[model samples]
Target: MKLRIFHQTVYRYDRPARNLVQSLRLTPSVSEGQRTHDWQIDVQGGIRGPGFRDGAGDWIEGWTVRGPTEEVTVTVTGRIETRDTAGVLRGHRELINPLAYLRDTPATKPDQALRDLALTAKDAADPLGLAHRLSAVVSDAIAYMPGQTGFHTTAAEALEKGEGVCQDHAHALIALARLHDLPARYASGYLHTTADGDAHEAAHAWAEINVPGLGWVGFDPANRCCPDERYVRLGSGLDASDAAPIRGIAAGHGIETMDVAVSVEEVERFQTQSQSQTQS
Candidate 1:
C-alpha cells in the first residue's frame, strides 16, 4: 500500500528576541517492508542547515535563528509505499538496537508496579498475544484525557493517575516491557484516521517490542492494536523525550504556545501497466 503524508508544526511566541535552536526528526524511514519517495522539509523564518543521522539512525536537522524572531513553522511532506509483512519488520535495520532499548533513560525508570506488570505479561509464550493482552490492559486501565501530565511525567505517575495521552501510554508499556528484559522502544509517528471519525489532533506514539524470531512489532496501547499500514514509523528512542518530533530552545521566556497538525491519507493504487500504456 502507498501513502502520502503532510505534517505541519507551528510555534508562536508572545515576544521575540535573541537566539533559537531546534532539532528536527521529521523524516520517515524505509525498511524492508517500506519504501520512501520524494520526502522534503521546508522551514519558514529560519535557514536550512545540515542534517545528520543520529544514533537512532533518524535524520536530524539543526536550525538556528538569531535575534528577533517571532514565529517558526516547519513543514514536512512525503510519500511512502509500504507492504504489510504481518507486522514483522525483518532484519536489524532499525537504528535503535533491541538489546539497548532498555539501557536506562531518566524518564522511563520503572518502579515495582511496572516491574510486576511486566512479569505478569511475560508469562505468555506468544509474545504477540502477550502484547495484545498488555495493550488491552493499558487501554482499559488508563483514561484517555489531556492536561493530566506533561512531557516530564513519568510512567509511575501516569499509572498512579490512571489517565494520560499517547505518550503516557507508550511510556508505561515501555517500562513494563523493559522490566521483563524484553527489548522495547518508544515510537513516535502519525496514525491515519479511519472513515468512522475525524483526524487526530497531534502526532501519535506507541511501543515496539522485539520478539525473538518475529523482530520488532509495534503495540499501540493507546489504540489497542498493532501498527498496520495506517501507521507511519518515524523516530524512536527509549522514551518520549528522545523521540519527540520537535525539540528546541528559545532565549526569551513568557509563555510559549505550540500547535501541531498532521494529515495521513491512503492513496489510490493504479496499475503500472495503465501508466505505461498511457505513455505509449
Candidate 2:
C-alpha cells in the first residue's frame, strides 16, 4: 500500500522570546518495508536549524523566535510506498543497534505494575506471541485519554493513573519488554483514523520488539493492533522524548502558548502506482 501524509504544526506565543533553539526529527528514512518516493518540509515563520549529527537516536528540534515574535508554522508534506510484512521489518541494515534498544530511559522505567505485566507474558514461546499479549494487556488496562501525561510522565506514573495517550502506552510497553530481555524501540509517527476526519494532533508513538527470525515487529498498544502498511515509521528512539517531533528551549518568556495539528491520508493505490511509473 502507498500513503500520502500532510502534517502541519503551529506555535503561537504571547510574547516574543530571545535565544530560542529547537530540535526536529520530522524526516523519514526509507527501510526494507518502506520507501520514500518524495518528501519535503516547509517552514513559514522561523529558520530551520541544523539537526543533531552525532547521535544513535533521532534528533528533534523546533524553531526559535526572538522576543516580539508571535507565531510559527511548520508544514510537512510527503508521499511513501509501503509494503505490509505483517509488521515484520526485515533486512540486515542496522540503522540502530539491537543492544542500544534494550537500554531503558529514565521515563520508561518499569515499575512493579509494568514488571508484573511482563511476568504474565513470560510463558509465551515466541517474541511475536509476547508482543501480541503485551498489546492486548495495555489496551485493556489503560484508557486513551489525552492531557493525562506530558513529556515528563513515566511508565510507572502512567500505569498508576490508568490513563494516557499513545506515548504513555508506548513507553509502558517498551519498559515491560526491556525488563523481559527483549530489545524494544520507540516509534514516532502519525495515525490516520476515519473516525476523526481531517484533524491532526500531536505525534503518535508505538513500540517495536525484536524477534529472532523476523527481526523487528511493531505493535501499537494504543490501537490494539500490529502496524501494517497504513502506519508510517518516521523516527525511533528509546522513549517518546528521544523520538519527539519537536523539542526546544527558550531564554525569555512572559507566557507561552502552543498549538499543533497533524493529518495523514492514504493515497489511492492506483494513483500511487501511476505516479511512480510516471516519475520513472
Candidate 3:
C-alpha cells in the first residue's frame, strides 16, 4: 500500500509567548515493512536543529520558535510505501536492550486487576502465543470509545473503566505484557482508515512486545490485530508521553491551547511533488 499523511498542529495562546522549543519524533521508522519518501516537517517561524537516531532507533529532531507571538504551527507531509510484515519489526537498527523496556512507567504500571488479566494468558505455549493472547484479552476488556478517556488515563484506570480509545488499549496491553515478563513499549504512528470503516483516530497508538527470536512485534488491541500495510510506524517509548510525535514547552505565563489534525489515506495513484527543508 502507498500511504500519504498530512498532519498539522496549531498552538494558540491567549497572551504572547516566547522561546517555544519542541522535540519532534515525527519521522517514520525504517524497517522492512515501510519505506518513506519525500518526507518533510515544517514549523512556522521556527529554527531547525540537528537530528539524530536514538537508542530505540527513532529519529529525533529539535526545533525552536523564538516567539513573542500568540501562535505557532507545525506541519508534516510524507509518503510511505508499506507492506504487511506480520507486525514483526525486522531490519531495524537499535542499541537499546529489550530488557530495558521491561521497566515500568506510570502509564503502563499494572495494578492488581491488570496482574489478574495477565495471569489469564499465562497458559499460552510460547512468547508469541502469549503476546497474541494478551492482545485479545485487552481488546475484550476495553470497548473502543473515543471520549471516555484522556491523555492522562493509566492502564489500570482504563482496565477498571472497561472503555477507552486506542491510547488506553495500548497502555493496558503494555501493562499486561510487562506483568508476564515481556518487554513492552508504546508505539506512536498513523493509521489509514476508509470512511466506510469504523471510526478510528488517524493518529494512532499501539504496543510493541519484544519477543525472543522475533525482535519487536506490534499489537494493536484497539483494532484487534497486528499492524499491517495500513499502519505507519513512527516511534516507540516507555509510554505515550515519551513517544509523542511532538513535545515542547514555551516561555511565558500565557495560557496555551492546541488543535491537531491528521489524515492518513491510501493513494490509488502516485504523484511526485518537490519538497525542500526550511528553517526560520
Candidate 4:
C-alpha cells in the first residue's frame, strides 16, 4: 500500500526566542518492505543543516533559526510505499550491536511490577514466541487510555496504573523485554490505521526486539500485533524521548507551548496537475 503523511508541529513562545535549533528524525526507513517516494521537511525560515543516518539506521537532520519571533512551525509532507513484513525489520543498515539496546533508560526502567510481568513469558519455548506473548500480556495489563500518563511516566508506573497510551505500552514492553535478557528498544513512527485500530494519537510509537535470527522485529503492544503495511518505521531509541521525531531547544528564556497535528491516508487515484505517471 501507498500512503501520504502530513505532520505539522508549531511552537509558540510568550516572548521572542533569540535562537532555536532542532534535531529531526522524521524520514521513513527504506528496506525491502517499505520505500519512500518523496519527502520534505520545512522549518519556517530556518536554515536546514547537514543530515546523516545514525548507527540505529535512523536519518537525523539538523535545522537552526535565529529569530526575534514568537512562533515557529515545522511541516512535513511525504509519500511512501509499504508492505507487510510481519514486523520483521529486514535489510536495514545499522552499526550498533543488538546488545546495545539491552541497556535501560529512565523511561523504560522496570520495577517489581514489570519484572513480574516478564516472568509470565519466561517459560515460552522460543524467543519469537515469547516476544509475542509478552506483547499481548502488556496490552492486556494496560488498557489503551489516553490522558492517563505524561511524558515522564515510567513503564512500571504505567503498568501499575493499568492504562496508558501507545507510548506507555512501548515503554513497558521495552522494560519487559530487557528483564528477559532480550535486546529491545522504543520505536517512533507513523501508522495508517485500519477500521479496528486502537490508536493513541495521530503520531504513533511501538517497540522493537532483536531475536537471534531476526535483527529487529517490531511489536505494537497497544494494538496487539506486529507492524505491517499500515506502519512506517522512522527511528528507534532507548525510549520515546530519545526517539522523538523532533527535539529542540530555544536560546531565550521564554516559555514554550507546542501543538502537533498529523495525518496519514492511503493514496488512491488522483490526477496530478501535471498529468504525470503516479505509481508509488
Highest-lDDT candidate: 3
Residue 46 local lDDT, model 4: 97
Q: Enumerate residue pairs that collide in model 4.
A: none
TM-score of each: 0.86, 0.83, 0.95, 0.94
Candidate 1 residue spans exceeding 4 A from truth: 91-97, 126-129, 198-202, 269-280
lDDT of 1 by residue, 1-280 (tens): 7877889988888898457888988887556656788788887867778898876667789887785777778899988887666656554354546798867676778877776666666667686677666777777767778888898999888888999988888888887777767788888887777667543443789888888778788888777778777777777888998888888898987567888778776666335646778999
Number of the top TM-score candidate: 3
Off by over 4 Å in 4: 195-199, 269-280
Relative to the true structure, candidate 3 reaches a TM of 0.95
Per-residue error at 253 for model 1, in Å?
3.6
Q: With candidate 3 superimposed using the best TM-score fit, by how many Å does residue 163's alpha carbon deviate from the native?
A: 0.4
Q: How close is candidate 2 to the true structure, as a TM-score?
A: 0.83
lDDT of 3 at 115: 92
Query: Per-residue CA lDDT of candidate 2, range 25-101, in tens?
Result: 78764567678888877666567666653244344445655544566667889888877777776542455568788
Question: CA lDDT, every prediction?
Answer: 0.77, 0.75, 0.93, 0.90
Among all windows of ten consecutive residues in candidate 1, which has the lowest summed lDDT? 87-96
User: CA lDDT of 237 in candidate 2?
Assistant: 79
Residues 154-186, candidate 3: write the lDDT tens digits.
999999999999999999999999888999999
| Residue-wise C-alpha lDDT for candidate 4, range 1-280, written one tens digit per residue | 8988999999999999967999999999767779999999999989999999999889999999999879999999999999999999998988999999999999998888888889998888999999999999999999999889998999989998999999999999999999988999999989887557555565899999998887789999988999999888888898999999999988988899999999887886333522565443
